[model samples]
Target: MEFIIDTVNLEDIKEAVEYMPIVGVTSNPSIVKKTSPKDFFKHMKEVREIIGKERSLHIQVISKECDEIVKEAHRILEEIDDQVYIKVPVSYEGVKAIKKLKAEGVHVTATAVYDLMQAYMALAAGADYIAPYVNRIGNLGNDPMELINELSNRIVQDGYDCKILAASFKGVQQVRDAFNYGSQAITAPVEVLKQIFANPSIEKAVNDFNSDWYDVYGEGKGICDL
Candidate 1:
């Protein structure tokens, strides 16, 4: 399973990527606005440097029309590296853009999906990843896991090369359920992902282990001391 962090903060990306098993970094217009970088392309280049060339970096296009979206995708590729995944919302025009981009061998991630049919359309357009808004769907009084389960089943049955990259998470449980429901990847805020270790019991357990070790090794002494 791929773990992706959805943030534009350089410090958070550097720290999280170092500690977490992160596979990618994803950002949308909203995420970029949060940082308000003076130069968008330069900031993204820095992000690419920190993550290096191995991990994928997903950047979204702000255009609504198919033609503009296609142009934006090309610009993003030129601004960033070609390996970066161009994120397109799953819509009529977006599907067209995805098809055009895929035709040119561009890595495309279909986003803003809330329905099974939308995801199916993205998969048909040869998208490398399809992102379903998990929390948004749940907030709309719909069961997001149902969509994920059915989509997962459909992907396996249809033999699609696409992966389910679940997004819009609020808590760690949402992230866990996304994976449990067969999402191959998830992009969440660094804070939300860090919540996985928020339990007080976890610290207490570690403290207990350390205390026992201290009794034998003496306080502040470690295995290296030997």
Candidate 2:
């Protein structure tokens, strides 16, 4: 499974990429507004430099209309690099925009997907990745894992090239469920992902091993000293 960070914070991106196995970075208008960089393009360029060209960068488009969305996507590609995946909400216009962008061989990620139908529409429209709102879906009294499982089965059964890039996670368990249910990728906040190592038992195990080693080798001694 591919892990992607869902914040535009440069420091978070740098740290996560350096320590964790992050495959990409994703940002929405709200996320960008958190930092509110004066020069948006320049800020994104800095992000690109930090992650490098190997990791995917997903940038959401602000337009809600079909024509404007298409135009905005082109602008994002021009401002960023061509490899950047334009994040378009899976609305009526967004599906249209996805198709138009795909026709021209542009990388697109259909975001804000809450329903199976919306995801199917984006898949048919040729989105490279379709993002489902996990927490949002659960808040509505629906099961998000069920959606991921069914969608994953359909993708294989029908042979669609698209992938499930699940998003909107509130905790680490939700992320694990996404992958366990067949999501090919998930984008979550750095804090949430960092919790994977927050279990006290994990740290205790390491401490125990170190104590045993120190008892035999003496304090501050190493294998090189031996």
Candidate 3:
């Protein structure tokens, strides 16, 4: 299961990249607004430089019109590299833009998906990725994992090429749940990824090993050299 950190802060992005072997980063308007100084393109360029040119950088288009979305997608792709994944909401216009972009061989992520029907719609509309908001659905008192599992099964059943990406993860539990349900990717916050390594036993084991090694070697450069 692939994981992408959903953040715009450079520090958080760098922290997650250092700790986790993630493939990419996912950014939205809200995330950009949170950390950036209102210059979205500049922030995105900073991210592109940090992650390098060969990384998958997912950016969302806020416009509702198909033409506008397509134009925005093109702008974002040009801002970074050709590896950008344009994320548009799951709507009629969004589907139209997705089809057009996909026909042109551009990777599209149909985001803001809330239900199983929308997931199928995204696949039918030729979207490369369908993102289901797991914590958001769970917040609405719906079983988010159920949707993740059902979509996973349906995608495999139909052998669709659409990737099921689980988004809006609350914590490590949600991340683990998405992978457990066979989600193709899990997009989560950087803090959540850092929390995954917070196990006390793992820390204790590493500290104990370091202490023993130091005691045995007496801070020597190499035991063999001694």
lDDT of each: 0.96, 0.94, 0.86
Query: Each candidate's root-mean-square deviation in Å?
Result: 0.8, 0.7, 2.1
TM per prediction: 0.98, 0.98, 0.90
* Candidate 3 similarity to native, TM-score: 0.90
Cα lDDT of candidate 1 equals 0.96
Model 2 stretches astray by more than 4 angstroms: none
List ranges where model 3 is wrong by over 4 Å. 214-226
lDDT of 2 by residue, 1-226 (tens): 8999999899999999999999999999999998899999999999999999999999999989999998998888999899999999999888988999999999999999999999999989999999999999999999999999999998999999989999999999999999999999999999999999999999899889988999999987877888
In model 2, the Cα lDDT at residue 56 comes to 95
Ranking the candidates on TM-score from highest down gives: 2, 1, 3
Q: Per-residue lDDT for 1-226 in model 1, tens only?
A: 9999999899999999999999999999999999999999999999999999999999999999999999999998999889999999999999999999999999999999999999999999999999999999999999999999999999999999989999999999999999999999999999999999999999999999989999988998988986
lDDT of 3 by residue, 98-172 (tens): 989998899899999998898888888888888999988999999988988998898889888878889998789
